[model samples]
Target: MTDHHDRPHHDLIEHPRPRFAPWLVEPMLRNKGTYLKVALAAAMINIFGLITSLFTMTVYDRVVPNNAFSSLIALSIGLAIVVVFDFVLRVLRAYFTDLAGADIDHDIGGRVFRRLVAIRLDQKKGSTGALTGMMRELETLRDFFASATMTALVDVPFIVITLIFIAILGGAVVWVPLAAIPIVVGAGWLTRPALDRLSARAMSEGLTKQSVLVETVGALEMVKTSGASRLLGQRWTRANQQHSDSSTRQRLVSTIATTVAASANTLAYAGTVVVGVFLIADHQLTTGALVACSILSGRAVQPLATIAALLSRLSATRTAYKQIDAMMETGSEEPRGTALKPARFDGRIELRGVAFRYPGAAEKTFDGLDLVIPAGQRVALLGKVGSGKSTIARLILGLYQPQEGLVMIDGTDIRQYDPHAMRSLIGTALQESVLLSGSVRENITLGRPGVDDAEMLRVAELTGTHGFMGRIANGYDLVLADRGEGLSGGQRQSISLSRALAGRPQLLVFDEPTSAMDQTTEMQLIDRLQTELQGRTFVLITHRPALVRLVDRIIVVEAGKIVQDGPRDAVLQSLQRPRTAA
Candidate 1:
């Protein structure tokens, strides 16, 4: 094969970009009718909010001074009715708001999870902990929608209505609350830059803290064995300190803004009263109208004060939206509308001048490499660690794409095949086995819908898992913990092997499959595999001499090049020959 040390060149695949809309906006738009209901309720609520002042004015100016007892009773009853109506409307607004929030949560939460599952492995950024933190931000977004933030936002526009009422009732004194509006808003605005910085720092430190915690818990055994507790503890302490400090500073800034807004509210009420005193002295305004002015002024600034206090949460929610949006926009592994029709693969593998390197690696694992394994052929890749043995298996499975050339199966490029359908017909066992939480039968079947117990038992027997299943009281019903935590290494490997074999696959790729087994177990597994793999294409990657029996041909790779290839026994003889000094 001609080696090309230069990087492989291929035209970039241009995917048609889908028109993007803000995720939060899109969901709300879909639920517009529900939001419209909330808005109408809020409008009615604000109109009803005027009832108290109006009732106070009527009682003080008309009923009390005129000694109209029947009039007072009638006004009281009317006021009581208005109060009930206001209460009902508020409740309805909250209900509709929460209903809309629920709909959004369902849609966005499902989309986030689906994106996480479908996103291309190479497109994924950040550590698992960071990703987890980003996923948690969805809760922040949902809470912002469901909390008082929405109410405050909706109520803000009604400040104009309140102002109009104040102008009509209190005349020139309307400017008192109107003047305070900007002061309250500015208080929140002035501290925003610092608040934003603190918010971002707090979020960053929070993710760091989450990362440390998750890392420590996931590797608790390793930390204990390796005496890494002190190091991890120090990291945890530092992250906690940073997070706490950022949070404290953030709250302090937020408190300052809230205090200013509250003071503005109080001053607006006091200012209104002070101005009304002059008008009262001149007999230009009545006591009842002055009292009504004070009440309306407070109402006017209440939403402003609320919005000021909620600035911190809004900032946090904004930060969260950006993070989630970035994650959602990542390229999916299976691109939409681009997947080829499913094709039956005959397991004839070929790598034509293939060149590949890992995402961030400095050196290429394979450069201009050529290899072929005909249909129904059994082959073993024998190489030292880091000699491109496992990389070959990954390429054949299309887990990673080559930077140049093609990896073909049955004279067709593997890239052109639908990944799901292609993988379903192949049995793969890696060097490290990972088992999910489930019973042995479920793990073996792996949620493949049509796999019955007969098929399950057949694979279990082939992988020698049937022996252990019989020993356990529950047989195939034995429940395994996450990552099979409670199981022995050999047992975990057995379960993994059984899963790979469950579908009676046409192609088998076993990488160090017997590494965890004892010599007797390995021998039995090899015997069973040899018989089971009849007429099937098999590729075995291993350093163990015993596994050579499973393949009729062997290829040895070194430093990204094939150094030896021949009949299995001949390759073994060549390897056994002693190296001579120059």
Candidate 2:
């Protein structure tokens, strides 16, 4: 085992150039036709918007001035039709925009989850809180697509159309509203530095707080037993306070930008009105046209204010997008190799000149170590703690690659075999039992197809799990909480053992598998396991001498080297002898 502090601080696998996020791109492309519909609807809506000014111009300058009642009636009907068309277009755009957003949300959400699961377990270390935060950030992106921000972005281009129309209505005076565009835009831009600073701080503090909470909850028993609940609470509260403070600052900056944009819009509208009045007095514009210019100026500035209002969400979403992209681009676990359908392993394991040091370790765990366990042999690895007993088991399982030399299965390099296929043929039960949230049958079978009730019950009975399952109301259907929370330590271990044996694997590796059991229960389990594992290749890693009787051979490891290896009787005799003084 490697010391935690000395372990390498970077990914063991390197990646090429950053990979593109299909989640972000695919959704947009899939809904491109819908987006096009929305855009066309928006364009129609804006075109109809011009009807207001035109209606005003005609009513004031033509109908009202001439007192033509029939003209007024006819014009009012035309205006009503335009208003109805505009309303319908607005609703269609909103509906289609939301539909497109839903499609994007569904697409990206599934892909991100799958990616998170597929990444190597080593790569996920210390990232639980960040991953949780990233998941929420994904929601932010989904909501952004459906949000008014999208509408504002789409409407922004229509400002050009609005300006073009306004120019025709009120010629040179159009400059008043056009000049105000930069002022509103600059106001939004100026706050970005502040927004970025505060948002980053807030996100960092938020992840810290979440990490602490998850760690504390996961180890609640330890915290309570150790009397460190208050300390944990203080740590969480401090992180929360920092997050809240940063969030407050972020909101303040966003608000100021929004207010500045609104003020600019108001000023622009006022300027257009005053300037248009002068143009009308100079006989360069009609009375109705002056009024129309004010309306057009307001329409043009609205999108900028909306965008300013959405700045905070945009900033947060941008940060999240970058984080997700980086996570996806990071190298995944080693490939499963080309040996898709490997031959059944005979379980003849060998290691030659195998030197292994964990990443960033100051010294190797072992150097030039050689060992062989022939097919159909039952071997016990006896060693003191930290003597690499468990490391040997992991190496055999291909959980971690050796830094030097080769780990061979049968006569071939284990790396040449497909990892998934290799693992399927080996059964392992570790010192710490792990059980997921599922029914007893599901946990035992563990997604192994073709495992039926009789096989499940046989393994369960052999591991003594059937005894407890009979007591539960649902029997094999009884559901367990995550980590087997409702079961006693011994019961959990039994289920873990049952899971290992359920698939009838060719290789069985047990590391302190009976640690949680009482003496009587341990003896019973060993007897049953010994008979069950008779013809299979079995490796037992244990400190208890009682377990040595199950194996035909014994090996003792000390200080990163094999100190003793012999038939069971010879090793037992050597162990019984007194140690000499140093």
Candidate 3:
């Protein structure tokens, strides 16, 4: 009977992300037919080994002892040859199977990484670590099975075929004992539902533990500051314990399956012996035939016993395959654009009644907004929080498309231009920016190749970063920490300016770029930007009203609509009058 509570628990747990595993399909299809050939070859190899063993029965069956020296020597050599060939066949099969399996894993990981890159930030926001686990560690287990480690699918049938050979040579009565095979198979079938559940739970708990550890490590500072170290430790312990419990349930099913098969083996062997003893009394069975049947039957039991265990493992691999498939099949957030490269600089932009709402959000962020900037014009964006300031920046960057109207650049709709191409046209120093782990030189000039050494030093000097960076141990060669954690906020911003300016873009955007710097540094940085970026357009989003002198125009937005728009002087006089806090 199904437990209703457990039913929903299993039903609710999802695979990392859904996509078809297209990468795995080609190699899998190539290796798909190899198993058939392997099975046939193995059966022939085993049959020879069986014939070698059966030859011993001829000695026992003969009335006069027929153990001549030459015959004994030849028989010994033949048996040795058969044993050696059997070992070689087994080893070769394992090697080829493992190779096939590794290829499948490679394909799965490749597809996982590629699909993850295309998934939208919102859809994949919650499963970073789980996605990593699915691509890397979890799929390793699946590799073993994809390689066809379920040799039983082939091996079991071979054993069945061997039984047919013996049953035909001997009497039809001998096959009565072989009926135990179905009994073992039946018991295994009964355990399938439980086994499937156990296997899926095993995978889920393992991935959960992996996700928790990764999350904990990422938030170690938060855990320390919040005094939740003990709580996190307990959570870690509990996760591992749950994983153990789930794995044990899987093992429990495996144990039952193995035991049932083993018991059936014993029953079949006993039945064969009992029937043979009676047949011997009736003079219906020869010692040679009886011995041959016993040997073949005994040899067959080992594989049948292992079948249940192999099937259980195969079930687990199937679960992992589905997870991999789900990620590969997911829809992409943006269609890839044909890459466009630039030859020169010209900056112009126009927005006509453009408006947008974020997916799943309750309200729109913009309503019929209209604006235009001629070549090389400097514009300032002023807005309170949630007034669609950041969203406007995203829309200009083509991170999101507007719902109502068009955004054009140089008289053409921006969407028709390549997204990657637009990134090169704009040089941006962001408020909450990240510096990748590498030398200072590598961090700067990140946008453009063929950056001259002189140009790097010039950009750094222009941004006021040269003063501090020169004092560091190795100057510009000093490697930043991951995310630039070792650097101060102001220093990071300066470096960001150097990196952005290195591109020599037609348009410059500073999203609160000077917010971290002191008044003296901010003044110098803004002056340098004004001089070096003389012909470039600018979108300066800042809280410092003192810096308003650098821009030609100002627009203030409130509640997703433009409250004010005019020359910088006019807007400033209006804003200076003052108002109460929200």
Instruction: Give the distance in Å from residue 143's predicted Cα in candidate 2 to where it truly belongs.
Output: 2.5
Q: Under the 3 Å rule for N, CA and C atoms, how many clashes does model 1 have?
A: 0
Clash count list over all predictions: 0, 1, 9
In model 2, how many backbone clashes occur?
Answer: 1
Between prediction 2 and prediction 3, the one with superior lDDT is 2
Measured over all alpha carbons after superposition, the RMSD of each candidate to the real structure, in angstroms, is 5.0, 3.7, 5.2
Candidate 1 Cα deviation (angstroms), residue 501: 1.5
lDDT of 3 by residue, 268-349 (tens): 6677767777887889887666767766666566577777767677667666766656555555544457544455547787
Which residue pairs of candidate 3 clash? 18-326, 19-325, 19-326, 19-327, 19-328, 19-329, 19-330, 20-328, 20-329
Instruction: Indicate whether candidate 2 or candidate 3 has the larger TM-score.
Output: 2
- Residue-wise lDDT of candidate 2 within 1-582, one digit each (tens)? 344333321221122236446768888888989888888887777777788888888888888789989999998899899988888888888898899998889888888777776565434533465567667777878888876666677788999999999999999878988898898889889998789767667776776777777778777889999999999989888888988999999999999989988898898889998998888889999988888888889888888888888887888776667666766765454455455447587889899889987655677888999999999899999888999898889888777778788888887777777777787788889889989888988889987885788899999899999988978778988888878887999999999999888778878899998888898988888788778888888999998777887899999998789999999999888787765322
Q: Rank the candidates by lDDT, best first.
A: 1, 2, 3
lDDT of each: 0.85, 0.81, 0.72
Clashing pairs in 1: none
Q: Which candidate number has the best TM-score?
A: 1
Q: Which has the greatest lDDT?
A: 1
Local distance difference test, candidate 2: 0.81
Residue 164 CA displacement from its true place in model 1, Å:
0.9
